[model samples]
Target: MSTKQKRFIPADGLAGLKQNFTKDALSGFLVFLLAMPLSLGIAKASGFPMIFGLVTAIVGGVVVSFIMGSRLSIKGPAAGLIVIASGSVIAMGDGEIGWHLALGVVVVASLLQILFGVFKLGKLADFFPSAAIHGMLAAIGIIIMTKQLHLVLGINPSELKGKEPLELLGMLPSSIMHENAHLAEIGLACLLIMILMSFVKHEKIKKIPAPLIVLAVAIPLGFALHIKTDGEIAGFALVKIGSISEAFKNGLINVDFSGITTHTGIFIQYVILYSLIGSLESLLTAKAVDGMDPFKRKTDYDKDLIGVGIGNTICGILGGLPMISEVARSSANIGYGARTRWANFFHGLFLLIAVLVGVQFIEMIPNVALAAMLIFVGFRLAHPKQILHTLYIGREQLIVFLVTILITISTDLLMGVGSGILLELIINLVNGASLKNTFKTNITLVEEGENYTLNVKDDLVFSNLLGFKKKFQAIPQGKYITINVSEANIVDHSSIVTMNGLVEEYKDGGGKVLVLGFENHRQLSKDPTSTRILKLS
Candidate 1:
């Protein structure tokens, strides 16, 4: 290990815990505050019993915490999986039993994810087009926002299952006439709070959890209006969490395979959806978390995948949502100064404490508040700014992005993604990418005494980045490098973004790296990172 690497960790594994415990514990508490509300919101958005999200968080923070290869990543139910989980429930016919059966599919998927990691297939994420994935996620965000917009406005769209996102969006004006004014006011208040919190200037004020702040006001006001006279809230939906003991007693560890046999086709579909999306999202999030780390430690991607898979399997059997290395919480963990896995474990501990000691308080939080938070998150995902950003990239990229979003909104997740991939291939072929060269890259590396020049040509997109990065990494350490992409006809968002990171690493390691030949190639956007280049014929 380098001296810099050693400086981050102590003598060995557990020994580092003592040095990191205090800061990690403090960070864990803050993350717990953020994760608790998000876990609830994500689960509600996913069409599962909201408690399942907390259960997933507990297992992720505790089990995966001990085993995860990444130091700062905190595992939990991610917003990206809301579509997969909600779609699975709807596919299985949408009921309590349907959700439990979905958990069965999660178990199967988790097992496959473990196998994928064992086979070192984490790089499979690289095969998907970057724009397409972003488009898919943006569609999911639109779906989430459309669904939750009703709750925020206090109008439940008559029947939510199997509705087109456009149809859901059309229901927005209906809420204006029929919405419960009181609840809508609260929801609007929470939404504004979330938006305003982002712009807060003071660091200390910024540290206050936005969701917690919303809940603080919403929960107290719920009683002020006598919303809950008995066990149930009169007009509004309450956050329902059955007893902790009941969670374990739900025949935990017994995964019903009846669905796999009876709905073999649907079961297989869910398995693929859960495993592929979960693994891809987890691997990507872990990589992003590594990039965000102040210590500059790269995570073992395969190892992290295997750990999350194992943890997810346990959560599956326990009737919990599938867990991933949740990106938002992981970023928060790093921001708050977590040094070891104990921070994650402590987060789970705090969540457990919340469940045990503060169940009533959690229940006191209004559903609209949670809905408002999710709606804000959904808007963030599918914001108009993102669409404009995609359009700025290029005609081809914008085509892929819009196609993926429209298809995903019109059809299901699988078909939408499939269509996106197929369209990407057709676009490439139309742009003069030959069949053989499409699969094979044309990179030539030349070395002269004090420097090395890499000549790259043709498609340099996400699909070929694994090979490209491998060759890039093989270059000797501490050597000046020049990457000449002037000859390349196409280069994508993920490739350029990754190459920029590598260039930064090269510069940090006492070696200079230069990227040349982009005077004519148009930059996609004004953003410095939107450097995706393409040759216009």
Candidate 2:
């Protein structure tokens, strides 16, 4: 008789470290190379001293890794949080004072994040529609690109300061015309390298991180172009990493809490943004990394939120940018064969070492090179494919996505996301979803031995998804479960996607799940996860 082969699962905690030390260390080193430049870029973009970025990353990896719920995710400062971080700094003040004030905001927000996990509200991330989240990210991407493009073209920071994203975009042509020749040459060269690296398919070559290659090429080019000389470029052109040792010697308690009293309204606003958005992004990244794990491990979202919150609190106290379970670095860690959380620890250890001992080498890096890297990152976030994919899902989804992006760019992230959610509700009503069931669960469960049947009689939409999930969770595992959405007035894209995930989870736990009632419904689009509404007789 043939038998199914068993899959090996790695041990957790100390055994995991001992068993997978070599693989984890190697992957951690590779991810360190990727994180170094990106951390600096994200920090500078957020209006903080670049060295603080490394500080945040170091804490994310070395500290959060142990406490985090996900085994494979690499925690660190991320490009996704740049917009909010920068906004906090700008809103609080502008320069050194602004940075310290923003740190205060981060501290309060991180405490709230801890409370969120304590309350087990990590699933609240699911409350945001998928299209809206994508749109929010795309909007942040555009903002990043617009702000960094001027730097990439070697425009003086003084001239670019205080200009809005759209206004800066309008000044791009003029900025290019007045660009510093030597700085622009290096920046453009690095930008070209970043763009070309994406098209490289050679297996061995691809294994080398792109950021390392950018640094290799840009450093020499900087020297050759005399970028450091007063004749060729301004003093601000080169990165000012400063002395990590000196900063540590001064003290870690650098945050300014006075902003809470002086800028009460703005302080509360930023606190909400930092905690809400940071938790959402970290949870989503953890979920994505879980899907990518070869061992099929799952993350405890609440624990992960607590870990991230702790890390952010530390970063804020030390005057560093808030951190998250960064998606790109986490994905790269998986690709590099990281088997445990130690990979994250090693990455942070390496960054700590670099800042402490390699300050001179880091100072040689050009600000424009970092700007080039960020611009490329921004381009990926707002890429055309995101729009195309959303449209392929459904026209209504496209509307929500576009509206989210537009509002995010025109106003702020909070308002933009709120608008998207509101618009989706309106669309749901237009499509015949009943108002009475919009925010409440209307499900009944029947038990028959090992078999359970769930009858959903209300609209299955994002607004009521949390309640629906709660009811689903009450069902015992390792049983046959049937979900009858046939009576549901409308089953949205979000609910459908969530249901699909629940089915997979149940099956993984030795239970069988069968979904019924979609046969009489009309799909909003050809995509399998698209929303469905009952067809007219």
Q: lDDT: which candidate is best? A: 2
User: Candidate 1: lDDT over CA atoms?
Assistant: 0.81
| TM-score quality measure for candidate 2 | 0.98
Off by over 4 Å in 1: 1-12, 156-162, 230-236, 446-453, 509-511, 517-537
**Tens-digit lDDT string for candidate 2 (31-126):** 999999999999999998889999999999999999998998988888988889999898888988899899999999999999999999998988
Per-residue alpha-carbon lDDT of candidate 1 for residues 176-236, written as tens digits (9 for 90 to 100):
7777766777788889899999789898887788888998888776666665663333534
Can you tell me which runs of candidate 2 are displaced by over 4 Å?
A: 1-5
Candidate 2 C-alpha error for residue 329, in Å: 0.3
What's the TM for model 1?
A: 0.91
In model 1, the number of clashes is 0
Error of 1 at 223 (Å): 0.6
